[model samples]
Target: MPPVERRDPEPIEAYLFDLDGVLRVWDGADLAAVEARAGLPPGRLGEIAHDLDRYGPALLGEVTDNDWRASVVGALVADGLKPDVAVDVVLDWSANLGRVDPEVTEVVAGIRAAGGQVALVVNSTDRLELDLVVLGLDLAVDTVVSSARTGIALPDAAMYEIAAGILAVPAPRCAYVGPHAELVAGAERIGMTGHLFDGVSGLRAIVETLSAR
Candidate 1:
């Protein structure tokens, strides 16, 4: 295959990124394991996992951790599992899953080497500091903004605003990269350039091209 042509970034000052599907691949294995332990069907677990992704973070803004746990437990109970079993299953599943992406580290390094500032903006229930330590992603990026800490998540616009504020750059001058189109759209809507990254090489090429431009 021919080399991918990259474009230079518009004299931008910094970069922002999303985690999960962008920097890391979260396979939802934890949710699957929880469902299996609860005796739920394969597809059923995926459905609940979708629901958690769709509603859990938003709900977190209004509910306590115990309340969120209760809600998940209640869903399991409705699916016919005992509440205690449901909670234990979920916790166990969560504990077993770990970060799977290492390419992100190189990409972050390239961005920094290019003299660009980078920050992580992720929608996560776990604390950013703890998760970074657990996943060992702290050395990859300059700063991290977790919804659990910022009280906002992707596609909300506020998360990007908060990130821009924290990075001390106008949103328009910052480039936001992620795998999700919605996040890209959100960045565009907020006046930032957005890149949908497929891998480190593609992302690095894009950044270099943008910088050259």
Candidate 2:
């Protein structure tokens, strides 16, 4: 692995990661597929994904699968598609999606090689087992906390607490890497080091810097 830039050590002991935009790019492709299948114009998925009312609680684990399905169906219906067809199309789009970033995998490996515990905290409607299998990511991390299982998602302090509890580490010693500023901020609020990961190199640098602290 390439050497990550170093920084003075802080107090971080474990690492928490967000799956979608942070660790992979398949999420965008899935959204595109959903919009295309629903015959909607571009930007629909982006709008929904960024809509705090829609995605916030979903990321925090406050939303249920049924709620997600209903919301998706409603969005497609508003876009002039049939509800059942929308549901099916969304399911298909998500089911076919998988991770595409090898650098992320390498970073996870590097974290493990450094003797850091790694965990996944993601906003997912489907069971993580299917997604992990499709992406071949099951063995890459120490634990996977999906909103589907945790009943809470990012930006919610409870979710971070749950992740810390599961990792057997204190919140202050854990680090969270995510693409969303709000989510990273939330982790920071809970005493976890927050790193906004734009790519593998950036994340590797953050990890190395933290490790050295």
Candidate 3:
């Protein structure tokens, strides 16, 4: 049998990560508990909070975080939740400090050890910066670009460009790790190598391959 030809990996100078599903995750059980206490169906809060129409302004920074939460409360009230109860539920939900994947930090360290820069590019609300601090992730990455801060959301080419610009690397020299196929496609469209992250093990493999180069 003929020897199979091996293709060399492209040069990757930086890594861009998606924030929510890639690195940080909220507790589903806690959310369910909140819903149960509020007499709302499971996952109802997430559906209401993340509905594109209601969330767009918040993600774009056109509305304050407080305003967005108030809108959620209003939605709950309209859904037959007592106004006070809705307020309390949202307040408790807001207090949720999502757990960060420790393995992601290890992967980040590996990337940095290999002379690669890292940045978090997220489509998130205005409170993202503050949340990072509270979550003890402010220093985890070299930089962070939130859609709310820039008024540009992912899977947009411009957002990836911004992160690449910050890292002082060309988009083609960057690797983007995101949980969604749409986001990965967006990164690839802008010439970046994209990895759809399923787990830390998959991410670690990428880091190992890049580090070996």
Candidate 4:
């Protein structure tokens, strides 16, 4: 990723970041076992995981956690699978919350130690915090702006605005960097310095761009 040019106002007061690709920085848990339990054809489990129509409500906090799990389990059972097998599949699916590169955590921790206020703004389900813990990442941020908790997803101006408010920082003084180009663009539209990270390596590029030279 090319270095982001610093623009307007002053050094950023807070940095709003994405989690999955940005912080996790790796292909997390393998879901092959979860698929096996559900007796799904290869790749079917991944498809269901990304089925927004099935998961959007859960991600938006419109459904309870158990209710959300039951939806997927129910679907599998209806697909000719036994009820016991369906529940087992969903239970196995929960094991792969995610994994984080400790190296990445150090980078964020370093930024925090240098006094950059940070907050995680991720589009995820209620398992976000659980995943964070499972990944062993000790995120030293002011607060997490979770779509599941806030009922607002990323790329929405309101999400970042609320995050800034929670961080007690001005909108323009906050910098947002994420993996999705659209989400970064969304942040840019509202005057926050927004950057798209290429991948794990791109993370350091981001830190350099934000550093005092």
Give the top-scoring candidate (TM-score).
Answer: 3
All models: lDDT? Answer: 0.75, 0.78, 0.91, 0.78
Q: Is candidate 1 or candidate 3 better by lDDT?
A: 3
Q: In candidate 1, what are the lDDT values of residues 94-186, reduced to their tens digit?
A: 465356476777767777887888999887765445667777777778788777776767888898888889888898789999888888999
- Per-residue error (Å), model 2, residue 82: 5.0
lDDT of 2 by residue, 1-213 (tens): 999998654678789998888766755666676678767777775675457787656555577555765686687677777878877866775465565588888888988998889998887765566767778888889988887677666688988888899989999899999999999999999888899888888887888888887
The C-alpha stretches of model 3 lying farther than 4 A from their native spots are: 1-9
lDDT tens digits by residue: candidate 3, 65-175: 889999999999999999999999999999997888888888887788767899999999999999999988898889999999999899989999999998899988899
Model 3: per-residue Cα lDDT at residue 177: 97
Q: In model 2, what lDDT does residue 25 have? A: 77
State how far residue 104 of model 1 sits from its true place (Å): 1.9
Per-model TM-score versus the true fold? 0.81, 0.77, 0.94, 0.87
Report the C-alpha displacement of residue 90, candidate 4, in angstroms. 0.8
Model 2 lDDT vs. the true structure?
0.78
Off by over 4 Å in 1: 1-9, 28-34, 49-54, 57-60
Ranking of all candidate structures by their TM-score, best first = 3, 4, 1, 2
